[model samples]
Target: TQLLEQSPQFLSIQEGENLTVYCNSSSVFSSLQWYRQEPGEGPVLLVTVVTGGEVKKLKRLTFQFGDARKDSSLHITAAQPGDTGLYLCAGRPGNQGGKLIFGQGTELSVKP
Candidate 1:
């Protein structure tokens, strides 16, 4: 089974703090996507990393894909209250596209 394990299931930080979340798996993936979900809303796509060792950044957020295509990371700088949300990583296996498996989800609380 393809499974993505996310570390630090919960995070609480004050404004301006920095944090990093990890996603790992034993199976390789064709592509990996990062999402952030707020209360009463669906997950919003943050970034998608397809190439091994690829790096992408969105303002204060940085994302990296593992060289083995079996892991990924998300780094946030200067977190603010607006940054609070559930962070999830999903992977597509073998080009199939019915449903995307999600992580347990990391709940983040950034207090201002």
Candidate 2:
């Protein structure tokens, strides 16, 4: 079974601060995705990284894939209260029957 581990399981910061979250695994993945979720709603995909060393940005948020495809990171700059939510990283393990292995999830709170 594939397992993903996330670091800094919980984060709290003042508005306009910067933060970074990490997700790692020993197994390689076919593709990896980042998602943002709010209370009472399903997670919304933020970005997908397929190639090693790929980077994607959505406004003040940035996502990066590790060179070996075994890790990923999300960075938020000038975070605001609206950015407070659950962040998740999920991976499609190589030949793993199409099931996604998800990280433990990061619960972030940005206080204004």
Candidate 3:
């Protein structure tokens, strides 16, 4: 079984602070996806990194896939109150018929 673990299960910071969330696993993945979920809504796809060492950015959010494809990180610069939400990392195991194995998720609170 593949499992992705996220560090700092919960985080609270003031607005304008910077933060980084990590997802790690011992198994290799074909691809990894990051999503953001707001209260009362389903998660929204933020980005997918298919290549090892690949990185993608959306506004102030940056996502990076590890060189071994077994880990990933998300960095938020100048975080704002609106950025407070639940962040998830899902990996597609190469041998698992492309099904996504999700991490426990990180809950962030950015207060003004």
TM-score of each: 0.96, 0.97, 0.98
Model 2 lDDT per residue over 1-112, tens place: 7899997899999999999999999999989999999999999999999999999999999999999999999999999999999999999988878788999899999999
lDDT of 2 at 48: 92
* C-alpha lDDT of all candidate models, in order: 0.94, 0.95, 0.96
Candidate 2: regions farther than 4 A off? none
State model 3's lDDT: 0.96
Candidate with best lDDT: 3
lDDT by residue (tens digit), candidate 1, 1-112? 7899998899999999999999999988989999999999999999999999999999999999999999999999999999999999998887567567677889999999
Q: Model 2 Cα RMSD, Å?
A: 0.7
Judge candidate 3 at residue 80 and give its lDDT: 99
* Location of the lowest summed lDDT over 10 successive residues in candidate 1: 94-103
